[model samples]
Target chain A: MNKTQFSKFVEYLLKNNNVIAPQYNVEAKLIIAELKKTSDFYMGTELPLDSWKWFLLPPKQKMFDYKGEKMTEALPSVKKQIFLGVSILDMQALTLLNQIFEQDPYYQEIKKNTIIIGTSHMPKDNFSEYFAKFEENKLEHLQFDIFLAVQNGGYKIYTGSEDGQRFLDNFKYKDYKHVEYAGPIREEGLDLQMVSVMDGMQNFHDQKIWDDLGKRCISCGKCTIACPTCFCFRMFDKSHLEQGSGERNRCWDSCFYNEFTQVAGVAPSAPKHRLMATTAQKIYFWYEHHFVRTPGTYSLPGCVECGRCTRACPADIDIFQTQRDILAARNKKKEK
Target chain B: MINDYQTHNCKILKVESESSDSKIFTLSLPYKDFSFEAGQYVMASLPGFGEAPFSINSYFNEKKFIQLTIRKVGVLTSEINKKKKGDIIGIRGPYGNSFPIGIAKGKNVLIVAGGIAIEPVRPIILDAVNNPQKYKKVFIFYGCRDESAMLYVKEYPSWKKACDLNVALDNPKSKKYIKGPVTILFDVVNIPTDSIAYVCGPPIMYKFVLAKMLEKGFRPENIFISLERHMDCAQGVCQHCAIGTKYVCKDGPVFSYAELKDFKTWLSPI
Candidate 1:
């Protein structure tokens, strides 16, 4: 691969727009560091626990405001930023997010505004490996506007489509050359044999592992917050003291909460375990099965397998292990 | 062009005290247009204490005004009881689906009513009596807690004159009152398989009548029932009058026994 200096990589991203590089904090956490062309921005070794959605679809984005009887839709415009250092899983997460927010009536406003750039993993410090149980699922290059695959020398660019090609042409890289082939990272295939996880992604719901994990879940909803693809929210209506005007507000919500389905004296999905199991089934098994041929076609955003949910889980429910255990249990159940 | 809401006045033509707590106010509307089929109801909005749906006891053949046989069990009905003569009230609608009178026309109609439930079916009795040739034998079997709870006090003379009427009180042992619960209808009448039965009463009475109907091999579509539950909006939107998927305001304050038989969440509010 024809590679340029990492310093030149910085110059290319800055020329087009503001760039957000994941810089390391003291606690080994990766935070989005706003970088100027001349800024002392050193990308941290680990992928940030956050997905690009904090920019695209924030947890509690106000959709509209209502008072008394008046209502108005909120703006979806955002500043153009080149999000560098995104992993393949992060790219998959964004694709799923686009599908979810773009269906039916279409949250197309968010998609029309943002430009996404995909990157191969390049870590220098403590990094959490997220693809252990998700190796076989190759990141579909079609999802992003631009793809950056990292090798030993430098980054090889692969423009997926017209939008991607135009983006790279505009965001011109200094002292960089295009190569026909992009090689793997220097420490390649260290754990590549466990790639069969692509197959493991399908049978997640009917596998009794859901009920077992769901029973122990405290319904805290920490996993959803830390997740890269959870996009469910609630609409709130507020009124002025005069009772003349009111605004409807948009806020993040968890399916785990009691009130999520507290309308009509009966909830379509109710009780704690049912919600969790159904969520897992809907996201993990249902979406993957329904959309395996054309992923994200119907807007079911499954976990990107980011592995952050495992860390955020106070109940110590490792989604990775839970998924593995589910597979194991299925085999056992089959034998019975 | 007055935008402010106004009340139309109605005279309290007569007051039949239903129970120690309940009463029926037969208000004679001045307008000749006051009409509704059996099993339909009206929303009596009392300006502020809020509007509520009440089953209209329509005796269409005789009555010139709209009559509401209210059980004084709630704030609105209790306030309605205190109203005497020339009382002004606001009313809207003969809302909701009525009892399928055309379907039950030729069938043997076994009419059973308990408590204030007779209010809705009272009109059907009048309509049936007006055209006795349309139906086969019409038998009216009613059981009230006491002699005073039975309504249609003035029409009892004519009701007995026109049809087979069996009225029973809760206590049969007392010479003044016939006793025992009304579960005896299963033995009293020979329910022809082709009979169409109409039942209305308290929740327990409705349930017991359903059991009796089932015991007599009555198909679900052959049985009709009028339901009573708390209702806020007489419109379908408020959702207060929901019984499972069926909106009691629009689909029915009246439904066939078959409709509610399998609806698990009808009264099982979460």
Candidate 2:
């Protein structure tokens, strides 16, 4: 299809459903928000300031409702939403979230009602070679509704799910081919970069690197907010003015915060009990979650390497540099 | 799909004061045929207050009810402590892997717990009590800050009938109890090196007790330790209780020393 058909397709989607696409805000910064018009869509190589998690896994979600000792499950009541102009890197992040929250009803409620339309547009500073260049074969490994592969004049379309095919069929477009949804694993097994970094962080102990990061990191947790796959959350309860009424809620939490690992103890009188007390320990934990824990649990690369964390860091803590340092420390240990 | 976070309302059957800071609340089974294994815990909560994981302190074989020994440390526990009999509280779980009772059946059982950590291991102790022939021998080493801090004092005589019970206090008021930390009990007692040891304690106690156990010829694989962490979702989705790749909420609140030794962040972050 040419540019005219694509614009017509967007117009059809916007008439009924809520269309979320990358667009320039008032500050001229690219962000993923509700697209009011087809002219506002910005399908550039630059990633948005906020990730797609804000839509799927909201910053704060209500999990349960309680009233007078009775508790009921409060799953998110989401509307039919379409995510357009999603980069391949963010697709990987969404695929990973799908696996991680496979059993989560709250996440599934939002996910089931949503449509993901991926694009072949690669970010300028992309680090993951697996997604550096989009290929037809990579579509099976990713979870999406529709994919718009940028070609000479317009876009080549592929349908990944029944929803995608139905959406295209409803638009009276039938030029797209269907791609079967295979699992997240590639035919060649785990990515080499993911394996090496996971091994380096898990096996090699480098205190100096964490110490340096600890000193530089202010622990504001902007990196966690910006990253696509950072989904750590803490559950809480909010009370209403009426007695015995409230909701059980969960919000995104960062490992950098002191309260992340805090436990119950006699605070003032006794020494506080916290798992990660020092900034070095907390920073190491943050890295360990991305490099070691995620890969070990899901067999997928935790850091999609969109360079969002690097850009979001106020302390100029480059995650790519940290990976290099971890690998260097492992190599030095091997030489001995 | 079933909502994993959904909780069932459990009626508080009875409440008994265990110590100055803690109480034992017996609750009706969340559902019919509700059962749990030793070392497993439940996410207990009240309406306005938040939820927290508490180990089921009753015998796993108890079909009618389960017990939780909650310490008045945080907002949730303090609220739970205020609850009386017939009060309803939301509970979900029986989460995490249990102690290796099958592997420990024919072998001697060794239990070492500090302060309130003994709650999780109470089911195992009750098992040993009810079935004396199930294991060769059962020995318990419990350490506390003082006499007032010791738990299950009323049941000590019943436990002593089925196992070798040793109590240690940091500030013992009399000669009836042993002195120093629980590690000192290792010096006086002669436990078989081959015994399957289950340990649960404060973070500080693990270093000393594990070193003592390792020095005493116990195998790493034979020792199981219960770790504590602040948990939100007991389904392992929440990252609060994660230790390395393992989620302590699901993978374990109890783990063998062999499995835990590999992760440097198990005890604390690297």
- Top model by TM-score, which number? 2
- The number of the candidate with the highest DockQ is 2
Writing each residue's lDDT as its tens digit, candidate 1 over B97-210 gives 888878876778778888667878887787766787777767787888776566776787777655567767785445753465666755765657577888887665766777
Weakest ten-residue segment in model 1 chain A by summed lDDT: A264-273
| Candidate 1 wrong stretches, greater than 4 Å | A1-6, A36-45, A104-107, A122-141, A171-215, A240-243, A264-301, B1-270
Q: What is the C-alpha lDDT of each candidate?
A: 0.58, 0.91
lDDT of 2 by residue, B99-145 (tens): 88889988899999999999999999999989989999999999999
DockQ of 2: 0.71
In angstroms, give how far residue A183 of model 1 lies from its true place: 25
**Tens digit of per-residue lDDT, candidate 2, span A283-336:** 888888888888888988888998899999989999988989998999998788
Q: List the residue pairs that clash in candidate 2.
A: none
DockQ of 1: 0.03
A1-336: candidate 1 lDDT, tens digit per residue? 244444665676677677776665668666666665534554433667665767666555544444322234555566666666666667767765655454311145556655566676533331224443323224332366566666567666665456656655555643333332222211243222122232333332244554555566777878767777665555444545655454434456654555443321111233221211334332232223222312222322245556777778888987667656655654655567
TM-score of chain A of each: 0.70, 0.97
Give the range where candidate 2 chain A is weakest over 10 consecutive residues by summed lDDT.
A263-272
